[model samples]
Target chain A: MAELSVRHLLGIKDLTREDIELIFETADHFKEVINRPIKKVPSLRDITVANIFFENSTRTRLSFELAEKRLSADVVNFSAGQSSVKKGETLLDTVNNILSMKVDMVVMRHSSVGAPHFLSRHIKANIVNAGDGTHEHPTQALLDSFSIRERLGQVEGKKVCIFGDILHSRVALSNIFALQKQGAEVMVCGPATLLPKYIGELGVKVETDVRKALQWCDVANVLRIQLERQGGDIAYFPSLREYSQEFGIDKALLDSLDKEIVVMHPGPINRGVELASDVADSEQAIILDQVQNGVAVRMAVLYLLAQKG
Target chain B: MQQQVILGKELLQVTLRRLCQEILENHGDFSNSVLIGLQPRGIYLAKRIQQILKEDLGKDIPLGELDITFHRDDFRRRGTPLRANATNVPFLVEGKKVVLVDDVLFTGRSVRAALDAMTAFGRPEKVELLALIDRCYTRELPIEADYVGKEINSMISQKVNVQWEGVDGGEEDKVWLVLSENG
Candidate 1:
């Protein structure tokens, strides 16, 4: 019953049910603000947010930038390739340099897991984890929840199937935790070698066959095959064509399921590999909904974290 | 805040019921009457009025909600843009007697903004304004509510906030005014 104030958003596991609901409610308020002719607010006036990204990103970085600017806060983009992070500068020292300029918040995306956790302890300003390697992308999970809740009215009791390479996807990990926390039954489907061992310990159902997993779920969230992050023998499958034929969600597969079952994909979609182009563009697909909800969810996060209380 | 408190919690409720009765008596046909509540508090008040009409006069009036923040002239000053809420009325507004509801009638700026916002949806036959409390000062525009709970004389520096259990639960129906330090 206490007033909600989110200082830092490092992971989905750090948020409670009430905290999630508050984010949704705050997003509902921001929804009205967005529909206005002059789409802006002065809530975070005089506040400066630094986006420190050490990895290649488009959606996550743009979302954080848009969210900060919408709140009328000054935004600064810091790239690892262009900055001292490439010249053997310590992470703490880089953060300290920005803090010296009186930054209010830091939204970071790093290739290493636990990077945000490491920064949270040292930084005085609020820290938002845009993505920290393959560990957890909490905001992505929140935006997914917002999209699902917007379409289905509620996430509780809904069956959600997360398909594709679960080993290297931070999105799959975050969605599994967030969806389960919201009372949705989560099922991850992928090749045996592509899935993590002991995934069930995270309270999710794991399966190797995509067809069987697609039968009972209300939503199918297909994750992109992270080819860039594959450092080991993760690609146990024969080829992209073989993977598509075996586990790809197509129109034929979608026809067998209930009409209400929705399709989703965190994009830069692999076309014919993990999901067919037709399925991604179908009416049942909420890919654009996820993008739009990203703004609302990020607004909720910034509002909750920036509150003085 | 050192402003005149014209209406308390008890008086506000009584006046709301009286306003409902007057609307029903004057516009008794109830054929094409729809109450559109503004976002946040107006939505709650519209529901209350709808319930009153249904209970007292045995008329089931249609209700809807309008979010006028986007149409506001002063949005650039308020920090952070918000998302739009569902304006859930499927019926046509053409030639319907639409009543706009709000919690407090301030500089009449919000109501003026609401009127401008409603035109894009459809043209109404007539539009009426209703408020829980009407402070009769700092009027930048020539606008007055058809139904008002109470009228108070106050300065622009004072802040008046009306909270309800329907919206801000646990501690509802509380009215507070904060005076500006400059005053």
Candidate 2:
């Protein structure tokens, strides 16, 4: 049996090249399993999984829960709103209490960076980070890389330019780790204000021009500006209009390129902001495929970890 | 490290022919029967048997592949994740008899997992097991193959290696009982 080196999937930074490959290979099998008439597999029937989402999310929460159910695992869902989290319990207290009920695995989404990593040290069960603050989103990066591989046949020797907010985007940081590990040259294309300090030390080129980045790469993973992550003191972008005009990915902007690059986004897509609706709905876009592939990617993660215990 | 050949190509061909004849006798036309290949290794034997049954009886029966990686009882006992084969059962098993095929029948745990996995498709009228090699007295579960090619004496420390032409990309079919690394 081929498996991950790490027990918990905390972030992409902790994953090696082979770990990512094993995940993609496993995801390839689960992708086929999900399309069959009986979409469920009786693999994790006895093992119970708990999905603890301290943050509000529509797609990630639903995707993790569905992946668990599809694997035939007994699932218990906990959100901050309905759970004892409203009663002012600590993260460890809420999770440890859930663990006391004999849960084998946890799928966690939190607003704090390193929350899953923090909980992993004190807990005994397996932990999968759905999305942890602006730190990293490992599964999203996996699916994005998987989608790019599906389009280009390989991730190595290909150019992947990530457009939009980088400082406040977990998707960007995780993808840079993932794509670079798979031998793809990565570039963060956005306003300099959104770009993090010493991002070049991560071995990625910082590009301010979106057109050249699109023209030079085979795929562009455009990220949203993160309206909530933005606040006073230091503005990431001067305004949404100026940012869209310069860094936004639209069909018209993409049409001017010599070749069409694959468009991708971690959704709750702001239609007219980071990417135009037409581009998101275009033939070149693989947003829906990414969503579809996310379930399989996560199923692979859970199924692999379930085998370890 | 030494191995002994139990059955070669000559006996393998004869065994498949006999299994086909036995199935032909049980269900004359195979009208309401579906053949399922237990995945990872069983699909080769299933495919060959399906081929022989088609050529002999002039029947095209439903053959599906079922992977029992998830249904295994010892998932947590291992340190690594199980590599899963594809489960490609296309037709329903609601009102049909399922003939489960595999390469070897050992402790019968895989067969048990296969039985559990069959429930997801639909309930079958009845299910039967067919294995090319059945190790006697190794029943961890109360399961037995209805049509077995050959019964061999073996120990838990030994492994049964079944090499099929279509499955293993070998020149011919053969079954060998070899000592495990620990043994």
Candidate 3:
């Protein structure tokens, strides 16, 4: 029998094809629960899921909350702005305090990379990394995989282009590993400065031109540019206009590619900077599908993780 | 009770090939058709069907999976439910002919629930059921497999399982028919 008991989804790199498939399968189950009149399952009836966000997040936090609630788990949201983190409590201590509340799972989003991994060691509760700094957002990657798998039928042997910010994107990093593992040829494209030098070492082809990457792939995942993470003289792109012309996915750039090619973005989208509003809102776009899949994927992650000791 | 056994591994492959041929012959154009397997055994069966169709007919079929535990009508009655397997359908199900594959068909509750679960994804052109073994009994629903391996009439207490190759790295296909009294 396939062991489905999985607790603590730390990163995409730790997941095997079986694990990925298990999540997809569980999400498929949740997909049914979601469409029900009550839209809730008693699987996690008395369990509690703590949403501890040390970093700011709207979509990720809400999605996790919805996922937990859908599984009938009691949810408690703790933001750094409202919690003991404001009173100089260390991250570990704050997490321990939350764990002391006897929550069954902790879905954490921190500004530091590997924060989830660190927390997993301290608490008995399952740890799910919502998004940590620029390290890895495992659920986002799985949802992207789910979205891609839904659109393409299978990720194996398909060409996937992940464009825009790679330097400070956990989503891009996670997708590179997840997609490649699922047998997709992953390509990363961005300004050389924004794209890491050793990214190609991850078995993904890194490109500097947007048009070329778009033409070569079946799916284009545009990443949001984190202006907050861009430091010093390296923010060389003069204006948003310049970035839009060079890196942004617009109508003309999309027109050159195959009509079957789908576009995606892990949202809170930067309207005109990394993606055009029209393209983001187009039929070829799966931005909303990404959000819908995010709930199902996170449910799968939580269900699997909670079952493991 | 006579042990209803599947003789060898080759028979399993042949069974799958026949099912694929039957599906192709009935469906004709596969452009609008998709196959979704219920998790675990069903997923494997779906993959096998996809392979047979690809090798025999040169048609690349869209294959996906569904985990039916959460959607089952008996979740509350069954205590803590088992963790669901991966559900991966990369294409839109709207207006496509969906063939639901499973290892064994018994009470038909699983297939009945699967049909209810599938409608949430999107409206499909039609959903045709396929199973390796159909233990003929009083089905909970009017659901019946469009394709079946061997139809066996069995008692409600009896267990009928269809085992395929590679289940435990064994190269033999074994069908186990066991009585509850033995346990």
Pick the winner on lDDT between candidates 2 and 3.
2
Order of candidates by lDDT, top first? Answer: 2, 3, 1
Worst 10 residues of 2 chain A by lDDT: A229-238
Q: Model 2 residue A258 lDDT?
A: 83
- Regions of candidate 3 where Cα sits further than 4 Å from its true position: A4-6, A231-236, B1-68, B71-183
Tens-digit per-residue lDDT, B1-183, candidate 1: 254345567776787789898788767868878898988678887888898889976767888787765456654344554444555554657788998898889889889878876775578999999987787877889999998876766678777777666564625565666556454
Per-residue lDDT of B39-110 in model 3, one digit per residue for the tens? 868887788788878886677888888766655666434545565555566676889999999988988888
TM-score of 1: 0.73
lDDT of 3 by residue, A1-309 (tens): 234435678888887888898788778768756755446665566678899998999999999999998877899999999877888999889988888889888998999988888888777888888889989998999999899999889999999999888988899999988998899999999988788889889889988988888888999999988777655666746666788788988877788666658999998899989998889889999999999989988887886676664
Whose TM-score is greatest here? 2
What shift in Å separates residue A82 of candidate 1 from its native position after superposition? Answer: 1.0
- By TM-score, the candidates rank as 2, 1, 3
Candidate 2 per-residue C-alpha lDDT over B43-81 given as tens digits, one digit per residue, 9 for 90 to 100: 999999999989977778899999888778888786555
What are the chain A TM-scores of the candidates, in order? 0.96, 0.97, 0.96
Grade the docking of candidate 2. Answer: medium
Span of ten consecutive residues with least summed lDDT in model 3 chain A: A1-10
Q: TM-score of the B chain in model 1?
A: 0.85
Poorest 10 consecutive residues by lDDT, candidate 1 chain A: A31-40
- Here the TM-score of candidate 3's chain B is 0.89
Q: By lDDT, who's the top model here?
A: 2
Model 2: how large is the Cα RMSD against the reference?
2.3
Question: lDDT tens digits, residues A222-280, model 1?
Answer: 99977675545545677777788998888988887666588888787988888898898
